[model samples]
Target: MKQTPERILLPVSPVFIAVSLFVAFLLNLQPWGHWVGVPDFVALVLVFWGIHQPRRVGIGIAFCMGLLMDVNDATLLGENALAYTLLSYFAITLHRRVLWFPLKKQVWYILFLLLSSQLVQMLVQFIISQRTSSWFYLLDSCIGALLWPVVTAILLAPQRRSVNTDLDSSL
Candidate 1:
């Protein structure tokens, strides 16, 4: 049996986490965001950080970001906030268990988390508007789930250590 080497990751910087979340927020603000299957970038990033750095990026940050999203999208004030807070709570709760799985297996867990968040958002929308959205709205969760591995890689890049550490160089 060939064992895959596990790379040691450095501590994630708070600045990097903040920047990634900001970028996701910007992505969500794009015109195409209104389209079905566009994926909720903010939700994705929030879950990622919530799981990886629960201590630093907890429900409070999620709530604040969701509020910002709510304001930006001009939706009900607390809709996104509630959804994101719950998403963060679950991610933090499952972080330890999810970390034990391989990337492929992790996708399922992430999909579930994203879906739950979407469901919460949809429910809120339904309650406020008294109308149900098309099933296509769920596509956003599916797309976000599919992007899990890619997002993980991109976000973790900064914390990855060099494959070969040079002993000769002393700074």
Candidate 2:
């Protein structure tokens, strides 16, 4: 039996991380964000970075991003901040375990994380508005989970090293 070699990933660039997060935030600001089944891009990206680069993208960044989301949405202050903070915390905590799983298996874990974040946001909204949102709101998390593999591929592209390296030359 032959074992497949694991591809070595280069160190992620801080600039790439920042750009990804910024793009996600912009996606969240789209008008379609309020539509059912529309995923929360910011939360998705946050979870991705939290799991893959916990040391660089942790709770503090999550909180700040959440606050920006709240301001943009004009929702009660701290609603998204609290949810995102918890999401990042949990993702960071489970980073090692998650990395051990294959991409397909990782979907289940990502689903749980995304669902929990949505639940927190829903609960906060309920508290502020005294109204219950339709159950379909959770669909966003499901969509986000389904997109996990694609997101991982896109986000990790910058860090993926070429399979063939020239030993004779140092770049």
Candidate 3:
């Protein structure tokens, strides 16, 4: 009797992509702070996916995802795209280090990544729209940073279980 291992799909499959996009749309559409803001849920999901499945999701997808967000939010074209692309690229570069770190450490790194992405987006908005930056610009990053742990916990739970199982089998 041949016992084959169950085929587990990559966590970041098309379904995840669609759900992420939908969440992004909701963030853009949701009436939050008098329609002035909402958390960048898509960015959060993308960061998780990037760290978890860097081999499948890459810079191009990140850029396109940002562009879609821009179009949906009616922001200057390429602003979100640039931010997302840069974030994704950096995440990919640091993926190995992030994976090795403990959850708390990874949350800190992801917070930085989220802030960096927002900084890039803010810079673009300032340059293109010549809009005055407000303190409120930092709010999304703060919320995202706070949510980082929760998001990471949810995303990594299954993987951790699988990894533990593998370790047990090897031992």
Candidate 4:
């Protein structure tokens, strides 16, 4: 009989999560020039963590991150917080189903969640500014949705582990 190798899921450090959030914040702060349609990297990370580590990164954390985003971007105080909170809610609710599927399938879900977040932010902006946005404003969600697979793969790389052949024999 042939034995199949098992991979272990190592625990991610809290420091790693903090640093990832900070890096995403920096990414969100980049000057995209006319590319205001750039993906919301911070929101993407929030949604990802909400799905994969719901307990550790719940709505509170999402809201806090959103606040940071709002402050950094000089938008209304609760704008990003509301969007992130909503996104986190959806991500947590769908997490179980997401984990059961392959990453390819999860991409669709990620897109949906991201779009929803963008919608919330847009609504908040319209309410506050009392101005209608351009149809082109929706481009950010599309761009973000398209980036789901790449983002997921990058974030998941550290969690993926193959058995170390020499170390496996000692167990």
Clashes of each: 0, 0, 0, 0
- For each candidate, give its TM-score against the true structure: 0.95, 0.94, 0.77, 0.86
* Tens digits of lDDT, candidate 1, 1-171: 566899999999889998999999999999998899899999999999988899999999999999999999899999999999999999999999999999889999999999999899889999999878888989999999999999999999999999869887875
State the TM-score for model 1.
0.95
Error of 1 at 107 (Å): 0.7
Q: For residues 1-171, could you state the per-residue lDDT of candidate 3 as single tens digits?
A: 555454354454566555665665576656562232456887887787788778777888888888888887788888889999988988888889997766667877887898899888878888877876787876777777678788776665543424344655766
Q: By TM-score, how accurate is candidate 3? A: 0.77
The global C-alpha lDDT for each of the candidates, from Candidate 1 onward, is 0.94, 0.94, 0.75, 0.81
Which stretches in model 2 have alpha-carbon errors above 4 Å?
Answer: 1-4, 167-171
**lDDT string, candidate 2, 9-81, tens digits:** 9999899999999999999999998799999999999999999999999999999999999999998889999
Off by over 4 Å in 4: 1-7, 166-171
The deviation in Å at residue 56 for candidate 4 is 0.8
Error of 4 at 70 (Å): 1.1
Candidate 1 clashing pairs? none
TM-score of 4: 0.86
- Minimal lDDT window, size 10, model 4: 1-10
Question: Looking at model 2, which ten-residue stretch has the lowest summed lDDT?
Answer: 1-10
**Cα lDDT for residue 128, model 1?**
90
For model 1, where is the 10-residue window of minimal lDDT? 162-171
